[model samples]
Target: EQKAVLVTGCSSGIGLRLAVLLAQDAKKRYHVTATMRDLRKKDKLEQAAGDALNKTLSIQRLDVCSDESVAECLNNMKDRRVDVLVNNAGVGQIGPIESLSMQDMQKVFETNFFGAVRMIKAVLPDMKKRKSGHIVTMSSVMGLQGIVFNDVYAASKFAMEGFCESLAVQLLKFNVNVSLIEPGPVNTEFEMKLMEEVGKSQFPGADAETVRYFKEVYLPASHEIFTTLGQSPDTVAKATMQVIGMRLPRLRYQTNALYTPLVALKYADESGSLSVRTFYNLLFNFGPLFHLSMNLIKCITCNCFRRGAVSPS
Candidate 1:
């Protein structure tokens, strides 16, 4: 029996790629319902899906923020049964907290945290009845370790992490597996757009020195880290596939190994000061040295992958 996979936010980036990948599976193991907020923005997904469209894959209209939209999309399905639900819909936010409005912060949680919960709630009852299902969420390393300037965004993911962790224990008895795909920096248009927007945004309440640090120091360092350590959306999609294929999916899976050490810093010292000081030094005290080290690691890792000596994941 083929699994019915419903993926949200399939217009572009990791969501679109994952939808196409699963739909194009040679074994025909999955029937993908690739959904987006607006069908008008589906040209990219259609082009990528090509022959898979209307065959192994179908596009549906789904706005995660709306209960009516989510319910309607699922109801449209033949059996309204979602064997695998991929909650890939999300939004990103950056810059200082003072500059961020309450509305803007609410929007982030609406899509990133509440949206996932909405979908899970809709499908979980059916999954519970069937005694089986898989729920996969697109989380970030920020969920485990918050970064400066990404306070709200990190909080949203942290909320997701906690929500899923608590829910997973109860779902285990019902044979419904819940997994979080935590990736480091992913090179996608969503990321590039955020970078461009942040450059133009004004931090009204922040001091001049803080604003300068954000623009001059933080932005450049962040760009370098993304350039040197970022994973392609396809890389993340592959990790999602791995999670889906597993007989018993783990609660958390980090997509990028390069970020393992950074996440470890948080656990290594419960004092919390270790991760904070490490990031401070890397961004301020040893900026140049940190950049050099990152570049060296990127070179070596790329070479190793090219030689087939290491897995990109």
Candidate 2:
């Protein structure tokens, strides 16, 4: 049977790739409802879906931030039967928290935290009543451990992680599986958006020293980290697919092996200063040595060329 799979934020990035992958599954395992905020943005997704556009994949309009939109989306579905719900819709925020606007910070929470909450609320009733379903959330490495300037954004994900952790236990009794896909940097337009934000945004309230550090130091180092550790959206999509296929999908799946150590540092110490100090050293003192260490991590991760974990296989 082809499971009814509904994936949000399918206009681009990981969502689009995952929708296409499931719809084009060799075994015809999924009937995909690929949704975005507006129908006007459907062209890229439609073009990519090709022959599967209607046959296995259908596009819908869904704005996760609105209650009416969420209700309408679920109402539009046939019998509202969604066998798998992939919460992939999210927005990014960067720069110093001090300079960030109130509306901007709220928008991050609205879209990233509450957005996923809204979707899960819409689907959980049916999933629980039916006693079966898979709920997958596209989380981030920041969710595991907060990052330097990503305070607000990381808090949003941290909220999600907490929400899911608490819900997963109850859902298990209902035979509903919950999983979080935590990927490190990915080579997506997400990075482009961040770079654009940097170019256009003026950190008005931030001190001059902090602004200089963000622009002159953090930006370069961030780019280097992304270049070194970023995975492709397709890679992440495949990881989602694998997680979905698991007989018992884990509560958290970290997609990039190179990032494993970064997250590991947090748990390596109970005082919690280990990860914080490590990030400070990496960001403030970033240089070729950082690059060399990154490359060394990439090399050491491979156990004779065949090592894996939270793998996108």
Candidate 3:
């Protein structure tokens, strides 16, 4: 029997690409259910799915934030047999914490943290009863290491990383698997939407100098890093496909090679200050040098990155 894979947040970006890729698999290995909060936004996925629609691929309405929606969607599935569950639904927030409202922080958790928990809760019981399943979550590099100005988002992912790490241990006994895909910088609508929102965001409690630094210094540096180093959503999707294919998928997988060194900084030192200082210098002390280094790295590894994305296995 073909594996039943349910991917959330499939209206766009990594979710959409992964759903289509799995559905269009040459070997007919998977039957994919691509879900999103709003079915009306599914035109892009429908267009991309092409002939696979209602055959290998099906679209469903699922809001990860709502327990009723999640339960209802799973109930509607044939036997609710989710061999694999990909938690891709998430929201992003960027700005100073002092300026951000408590509601803003809660909103990010609502979609990024609690959302994944809701999906896992809705599916894990049946997975355990069957004695097999894969829980794949779309995490971020920030989950491993925090970035300046992305405090709340990083915290949310960190919570997820910890949650998954703890859960994986127990799930091992049941022959179930858990994996976290930690992509560095992916060029997706998620990034674009956050960037646009940041432009209009008001820093209520933050001082003018701090606000100016964020807008002038941080945003430009961030833009350069993303432009020079960001991978496409398809790259992320390909990585996800590879993880799904593994007999025993890794607990944590980072999608970008260029970012491997950055994440390694956390483990390379026992003091923890090494990672903190490195990021501080990159943001404040070596802005120009940092951009130059990223460009050079991109030039040197562009071909390798492209090849990995094309043939993820």
Candidate 4:
């Protein structure tokens, strides 16, 4: 029986591309199960594979948000063992913390963090029972360094990185390998979806403070950075496939263009060459300074107002 690799979020983006590439390789390397949140999206997944490659790919429904859904999906595959599970289903919510409620943060985690966790739990039993399997997580550079207006999304990715790190250690004894792919912004529907969701939260009023804030603070940079810094999602998908085939895969892999720069920055700080970190520090310092200046002004105003009319001694 050919080894089976299950990839989540195959409806589009890196997951979909990864599924197709894995299925199309002439070796018929593995049976690719391309699972999406909805079967309707499977048509596109299948289309990505085309008639010839589609034979190697199987589309399935996998709602990572629901435990029952995850369990049912796994149970249905009981006849075929899953040799590798790619936790790629995720959502990105970007907006001001003040505007987005706690529910908004929770929603991000449900799909990006806990959703991966749920899938891991569902597949681990089998992976452990077999004492052989690989678990791959899709993380982001934001997981390494947080950025503005992406606090919730960054937090979820951070959680994934940390979980995968710990899991890598724990799973080694079971002969199961765990790996994390931290990519920078990728050109995909994923980016558009994030922008759309964030844009939607701006309330009805055209001139409302929330809308104005998003326009002034978030939109400009996300637009510039995403377009300028982003790379094709296939870059990440190919990296994932490479990692999966490694007999002794590294604990973590960084495939984005920024990966090397970030690593250099990380070690530069440790080695006392502070150039890059200093640059970033200077870039981010304005936010704190601006907040401090605001508080200082408020204090001065309150003090002036509280000064009762001077008594004419």
Better TM-score candidate (1, 2)? 2
Q: Write the per-residue lDDT of candidate 3 for residues 1-313, one digit (tens) a residue.
A: 8999999999999999999999999999999999999999999999999999999999999999999999889988999999999999998888888999999899999999999999999899999999999999999999999998999999999999999999999999999999999998989998889888987888889999889878987888888889988889999999899999889887998888877677777999978999999888888888778788677767766554443222365
Question: Which of 3 and 4 is the better model by lDDT?
Answer: 3
Model 1, 1-313: lDDT tens per residue? Answer: 8899999999989999999999998899999999999999999999999999999999999999999999999999979999999999999998888888899999999999999999999999999999999999998999999998889999999999999999999999999999998998999887887887886887878888888878878888888889889989998898798788789888998887776777878989999999999889888887768788677656665554333111234
Write down the lDDT of every candidate, Cα atoms only: 0.90, 0.90, 0.91, 0.75
Against the true structure, candidate 1 reaches a TM-score of 0.95
lDDT for model 4, on a 0 to 1 scale? 0.75
Off by over 4 Å in 4: 52-54, 78-80, 203-214, 263-267, 270-313
lDDT of 2 by residue, 59-117 (tens): 98999999999888888888999999999999998899889989999999999999999
Candidate closer to the true structure by lDDT (higher is better), 2 or 4: 2
Candidate number with greatest lDDT: 3
After aligning candidate 1 to the native by TM-score, how far in Å is the CA of 112 from where it should be? 0.3
TM-score, every prediction? 0.95, 0.97, 0.95, 0.81
Highest TM-score against the true fold, candidate: 2
Pairs that collide in candidate 4 are: none
What is the Å distance of residue 203 in model 1 from its true position?
2.0
